[model samples]
Target: MLKFVKGYMESIEGVATYPMISLLIFFVFFVILFWWVFTATKEHIKEVSELPLKED
Candidate 1:
């Protein structure tokens, strides 16, 4: 099954760049998410964490 899929993918033109582009996008998203998490205020984190226990 894996060999068949690999052969199919290899037959397509420009398929190689798709994996690189997807990896770049995934890396960029995680970097942004990490920056946001690290830079977030303690007060905001506390407020958000308590949201589930608070009444509507």
Candidate 2:
């Protein structure tokens, strides 16, 4: 099964770049998220984190 799937994938043109593009997108998304987490205000983080426990 693995060999058949690998052979089918190898036959497709430009299929190799798909993984690289996916990896690049995955990496960039995390980097942006990391930056956002670090730059966000502590007060805002605390407020948002308590939302679930807060009673309306």
Candidate 3:
């Protein structure tokens, strides 16, 4: 299995550059995704909370 993966990777043209590009793309995607989640969480926190109301 290891040999197969190694052979497959080696067969690709410009194999060295492929990993670098993949890493960069993943990093950018993760950053954007985290930023989006952070903004959404902040918006959620600002909204009202659900709790039982007590009668005076």
Candidate 4:
């Protein structure tokens, strides 16, 4: 089953770049998220965190 799937994938043209592009997108997304998480304001974080406990 694995061999068959690999063979099918190997037959496709320009398929290898897809994985690299996907990896780059994910890497960039996480980097930005990490920066945002670190730089976020404490007051904003506290407000957002307490949102669930607040009654409408």
Candidate 5:
């Protein structure tokens, strides 16, 4: 297990792609958040649409 950890650490140290990995993570998070917001908004619109219309 220690050897595996050491190898993994060495592999991480050899890479200069931290920014790319971080950007990918951020993009994935943003997509999930946007999807959640879209569904919530759609539900709210449907609920509002079903409300009893006030007869002026």
Candidate 6:
């Protein structure tokens, strides 16, 4: 099964670059997410975290 799928992928033209582009996109997304989490304010985090327990 694995060999069949690999052969199918290999048959497609310009398929190799797809994996690299997808990896670059995933890496960039996590980098931005980490930056946001680290730079977030402590007070803002506390407020958002307590929202679930607060009454409407």
Best by lDDT: 4
Q: How do all models score by TM-score?
A: 0.84, 0.92, 0.49, 0.91, 0.45, 0.83
List clashing residue pairs in candidate 4: none
Clashing pairs in model 1, backbone N/Cα/C closer than 3 A: none
Residue range 1-56, candidate 3, lDDT tens digits: 99999999999989999789999999999999998877786546555232235334
Q: Using alpha carbons, what is the TM-score of model 2?
A: 0.92
Error of 1 at 45 (Å): 0.4
| lDDT tens readout by residue for model 5, 1-56 | 99998888778864657879999999999999998877787778777777877454
Clashes of each: 0, 0, 0, 0, 0, 0
lDDT winner between 2 and 4, please give it. 4
Residues 1-56, candidate 6: write the lDDT tens digits: 99999999999999989999999999999999999999999999999999999998
Count steric clashes of candidate 4. Answer: 0
The TM-score of candidate 3 is: 0.49
- For model 2, give the 10-residue run with minimal summed lDDT: 7-16
lDDT value for candidate 1?
A: 0.99
* Candidate 4 lDDT, 1-56, residue by residue in tens: 99999999999999999999999999999999999999999999999999999999
Once fitted onto the true fold, the runs of candidate 6 whose alpha carbons sit more than 4 angstroms away are none
* Superposition TM-score, candidate 1 onto the true structure: 0.84
Query: In angstroms, how far off is 36's CA in candidate 1?
Result: 0.3
Better of 2 and 6 by TM-score: 2
If the candidates were sorted by their TM-score against the true structure, best first, what order would they fall in? Answer: 2, 4, 1, 6, 3, 5
lDDT score for residue 47 of model 4: 100
lDDT of 2 by residue, 1-56 (tens): 99999999999999989999999999999999999999999999999999999999
Model 4 error, position 16 (Å) = 0.7
Which is the better candidate, 5 or 6, if ranked by lDDT? Answer: 6
TM-score of 6: 0.83
